[model samples]
Target chain A: MTFLDFAWPSFLAPGRLWLLAVPPLLLAAYIFLARRKSKQGMRYTNTGVLQAVVPPQSQWLRHVTVGLALVSLVALALAWARPFGTDKVPRERATIVIVLDVSYSMEAVDVAPSRLAAAKQAAVDFVNQLPASYNVALVSMSGSSSGRVPPVTDHNIIVRAIEALETQPSTDVGQALEQAMAELDQAPAGEDGDPPPGLVVMLSDAAGTTNPDKSPRQAAKEMGDRGVPIYALVFGTDNGYVDIDDVRYPVPPDFSFFSDLAALTGGQAYAADDASRLADACQKVGSEIGYVEVDKEVTATAAGLGLAFAFVAAVGAVMMGARWR
Target chain B: MAQPAFASPAAAVSSVVTEPSGATIPLSRLAPEAALRRLELTIVRRLEGFLQGDHLGLLPGPGSDSSDARVYNPGQDDVRRMDWAVTARTTIPHVRDTVADRELEVWALLDATPSMNWGTGGVTKRDLGIAAIATVGFLSQQMGDRFGGLIMRPAGLRRLPARSGRTALYGLLRSMLAEPIVPDGTKGPMDLPQGVAQMARSQRRRGLRVVVSDFLTPGDAELDPAHAPAWERSLRRLAVRNQVICVETVDRHEIDFPDVGEILIRDPESDFERYVNTSDEAARLRMNAASAAQRERIRIAIRRSGCGHIQLRTDRDWVQDIARFVLAYRRVAGRLHAPPRGVSR
Candidate 1:
């Protein structure tokens, strides 16, 4: 990326930022001298000859050269402080937990065939796309949440568990998030004895009934505190419904809850009304969680830009100066 | 900063004046007086066929002033001087005796306008012109001969009454040096032409007249040598009854431009201002050519006016230039000043 668009960097030697004051001082001095020179002009006994001889010069060219020189100086001053910018790097160790909603509302056919079928297909695609080295886990949300598969490098086990999830009575998103966090806690540590980076991906149909003591929002907050972010996908449309005992109950998906949960956990939220949209959301989340951000030294890029600007300024100065002889 | 290409040794001496607009130049108190002593000075009025005798008198026989008539001698008295009325009444030739008129008056008109206030040498052009006047005053200071001065500025003309003696000459020089400097863009009815015309009108005498100036008229862009300058008509008129000498003062840098990069060139007497890049060799050459042409035009115009012209550069010693001109003038003074046979005062 170009240095301009690079993240505003952190400085290693911040005290050197004091050098930033030099360019303005230089500009002020230049302006002062230029004004004095214009005011106290060289007097000629006769200007008729000069008028006939000399053509009017492009006065702005000199200012442009000076401006370029000043910009180069500012760049060099910033580079001298030794800056660090955020760089994207692939994580060597990570644990990804997929939570599928298997509530009776997910059995609605608004997402073609059923919401559960679309969720299962998207989850399997997401698991297959992840790096083979990463450990994967699966959890089911029904009357209560439970871990179906523990964190393991074997991706087929998690995919099969996601497909086998059956619809049940209630939607307990809070319980499912708690179970995903538990699975992440049991994950194996790295060679340096630090827990692997973790991400939770949740696919749900509708809002779960309120649990007074611990809501889904509260569980998402706890998951964020444990250094894991949730990427939530809201499946099914507002017209989705389920049938029971000859009574039709409208079970439209609750997008606001998934939006709040994703926001609280520092992750993204997606709403999908069809299987294609669900698959697209799953693909985006897979790519989003694949890398990590770390501060990397970008001093050379800044220095090179400074040198390029300085070189252009010097060339301009020399061209103008040559005629001074 | 790099030194400007046009910077020279002559520019080392700054023109410092006590008056506003850089006027009120001090007298040239340097070594010109000492150096001028060895050179002979003379006004070539006699060669013009008007002053027909030696320095003591002009046409030194019977003067033109009428006196009592007397009987004409047979062979000695000329018929031209005979009183025809008296001769016819008496039927005998009678001649009118006349009183001799003698005394030479010299008037020097110095242009002290704003343009003369500039100099890159030891003295400004105004002060140098004054020095030339002082030199002329010393050269022509005689017992009966009176020396006078006229100072021309943009505002008006100042006259110093003619008087004899070294003290009066010193007084005139002091008044000239005390004249205030005219600020730039000063506008008035008076100009070089008007000033010269006034000198010709007020100072009506048959003697010598000296006009000193840089001869640059403000707002006059005419450069052709064939066309006469605005002041040439007045100068020619002044030269009609009196022998006139024009001392043209100039600065060396006016003709030879130096490489000073970019600079604003301004005219002190006019509102003309321009930025010039002297670094361009081609531009400098063009400027030099134009300036030379300009000076040449001035030289040609003065010559056409039938007056003696001498150029004095601010970069050089004024006294020396005048001395050289005078010495050379002595050799061709008679032949050069001789008017055409049909022309007479």
Candidate 2:
């Protein structure tokens, strides 16, 4: 985000914002009173002679203290409105699931080494980039899907799970996502009644399987209904080839299917020839994934600032020794 | 001839009079009796001892009876008063001297205009003017001479008829002290010269006429010689018949501007206001020069009119200055058989 990008989640009482205009009005009145006071000071009998003896001094400097006090009052008014801004604070009590496809087709050597190897490496890189407070879970899917690592905060366990994945018969993206969600549900609940925000990141070479019982779209619908986003990455090119049982076969990647699945789950879809694009997507997801609007009271802070300004103004007035009638 | 014994025991009093304190006693704030007591203590007692002898003896007199024959000293005795009978008998030059006439009248013309209300010193010019009047009045009372005065205020002229005794002198002094002084409220310029001229016409008696003022008149004798100041002309007319003494009162602020950065000055008599920069050296010098020139003009006018000139300052020991002047006049008078040259009586 740019420097000016910020959010105010909630204002307890936003109606008090109208009071912000009062400082300028009070400043005008203060200026008038100060000028009048200067004019109406002691009346001398021999002003002619007195004028010869003493002249007027600069009055602009005298108003500085009052100006500070007015500004503080404005700040106090803002604090009274109870503003809460969305700050880029550290992510806490969050769970992120990384789903990897270990099907035979993922072994196509189109994206340097093989698609499966590239996915494994991207998964490890994604887990490493996440905030340490986040609990990461690993799930592998082929003919059947299973949770390799339950939701855990240790980076070594998640990395080991990604490295241990082996090639299986076929791809089942829906089962893999369902397994990741099931692991997130089984994980320990946070201090709040509800579980922490959950995210499912699936890395695969979208090769359609003839398994009608488990539909990827239906699975994405379920995750979406649970307010979870499924970020899908297609990791192979159209010119990819795979060898099965000593026979080489051309297995092209279907980017449209994975893109459709990510759209159904309110998430993004990415196509990467190597691990660089996947790594960038992982960093974006880590930064943008989970943020809860928490009410932070700023009344005391603003009032303290206002009081500080008031103290300065008071000290200045005393030092100047102006007649305050 | 033997000099007249004008000495009194009161002459032994210290000539070095202490300067008046800066604290001013506002007469309006005090009761009449209290104010009179303050004036008596502050001004009268200090002057009474030093100036207790005959007031008329300070000036040359025309006596109806001859008193004594004296050897005439050139330039010291008047040629018009040469005694032929004494000269024919003594061979040496002889001049007949006459004792000063009694029943002398002392008239004081006090300028209580709005300008007198201002002073940066301990006392204002008005306060000093009253003190001077008190000194002169008490001295006249001591000499058993009739005392009277004319006060020129911003409102109008006030005249006090000639009267004798201490009570009358105190009453006149109280009136002078009680005159109201308004700040920047005078409607128009005060006609001080006119008032002096009027006073001169009214008090035509051959006596001492003392004029006490700050002398900040608009008329310039050197710049406008054709139309000499009315006061100067009045002084000349008054000097023709009376011993005129001009007690010019001044304040230190009038002589030099203080180093105040800037100021708005308002003329009390004319109600005119002007902004000034006192910190500017050139401006300050210009103001000082103008003040000095104005003072010199007034001095020249008084001197040209052949009157006794005494300057009293608000910041200095005015009583001491007056005493010194009176003593010096007495010493000069004792040395010469006639009044000092150019001095009018």
The number of the candidate with the highest DockQ is 1
Interface RMSD of each: 3.4, 10.7
Docking class of 1: acceptable
TM-score of chain A of each: 0.80, 0.66
Please report the candidate that would top lDDT against the real structure.
Answer: 1
In model 2 chain B, the worst 10-residue window by lDDT is B41-50
The regions of model 2 sitting more than 4 angstroms off are A1-325, B1-23, B26-100, B188-190, B218-230, B331-345
lDDT (Cα, tens digit) per residue for candidate 1, span A217-299? 88999988887999999989889998967889899888988998899989989999999999999989988888888888888
Tens-digit lDDT track for model 2 on B1-345?
A: 221122221221110111122214443321233323323211110011112244334323455446678899999889988998889988988998874545657788888766666555556666677777777665545445678888886666788887888788777777776665543445544466777777778875556778888776632223333345557877777666566778988877678766655444444544344444556776667666666766677777877776777888766766566666766665443332223456433
Q: For residues B1-345, write the lDDT of model 1, one tens digit per residue.
A: 222222233432443222234332344452245555556556555322233233533343456657578899989988888899998999988988764445568899998877777776656778778878988777665546688999998889988998877778888888887877777667888999999999999976667889998888665556789988899999888776677889999877766776767766666666666666767888788778877888999998887777888898776766667777888888875555555455553
- Checking candidate 2 for backbone clashes, the offending pairs are A48-B265, A48-B266, A51-B263, A51-B264, A53-B260, A55-B262, B22-B122
Best by TM-score: 1
